[model samples]
Target: MALFKRLAERQRPVLEFTLDGEPASGLLGDTLLTAVLTSGAHLRGSDFSAEPRAGFCLMGACQDCWVRLGDGRRVRACATALEAGQHVLREPGRRP
Candidate 1:
């Protein structure tokens, strides 16, 4: 039953981005932070475990999803859906 339940779960969406200047791909829909952490990408992004950051509120109530856009702007990853060709920077403060 457990195995069947796992297979019954819908597959996560896919996201394409770069990690440490290297190309990478990952599932979307889930929180960006969770996706990044599971992707095994080498990044210097926000320390979600430290520095007053927390993902307990997955509903975007908290600003913990804040991420640096490739254009040098900050946006919440939870509130923003992943785009096919969108450029993304992992950390909260950084410019691509």
Candidate 2:
């Protein structure tokens, strides 16, 4: 169950990646957040609440879209571009 769906087909090439160790792919220019949500993956769970967060502001100012890359770097998903072979993961124990 994806949270989003593309409105129309585009010619951009798809880049392969992984989300939580599961195979996934995204359009070449997609932001990490866009890739994650559109794949039916949930954003990180809120630290203060029981609800899951889907990034309050699409921009990078909210500090709400942090996610870990496979290389162990934490990044703001909303501001990061999805790249080929990139691996994204929800911070451990933060599952919604």
Candidate 3:
């Protein structure tokens, strides 16, 4: 189950990745925020509210779309590019 459905630009090359240990794919040149939301079930749950967050600003300004990389580094999904074979965890500080 995906969050946001892709309505346009469906012709780009697909890039494969993992979301919380689950295999997922997204279009090339997509942002991590868009990739995960459209390919996975949902974004990371909020720490403050324990509810799902899609992202507030949709840019790099807000601190809402943070995700953990395989190396344990934190990055904003909204500003980060979707990389091929990326291991993304919804929980911050979680290593792949």
Clashing pairs in 1: 13-28
lDDT of 1 by residue, 1-96 (tens): 010111332576677776445565555564455444444432233464333232445577866566666777776766666565456666633333
Ranking by lDDT: 3, 2, 1
- Show pairs that collide, candidate 3: none
Tens-place lDDT digits, model 3, residues 27-86? 999999999999866678787765777778988897989999999998999999999999
Better of 2 and 3 by TM-score: 3
Clashes of 2: 0
Preferred candidate (lDDT higher): 1 or 2: 2
Off by over 4 Å in 1: 1-13, 28-31, 41-54, 92-96
TM-scores across all candidates? 0.55, 0.88, 0.89
In order, the Cα lDDT scores of the candidates are: 0.52, 0.84, 0.87
lDDT by residue (tens digit), candidate 2, 1-96:
778788766678998899989988889889999888888647777766636678889899999889999899999999999999998987543334
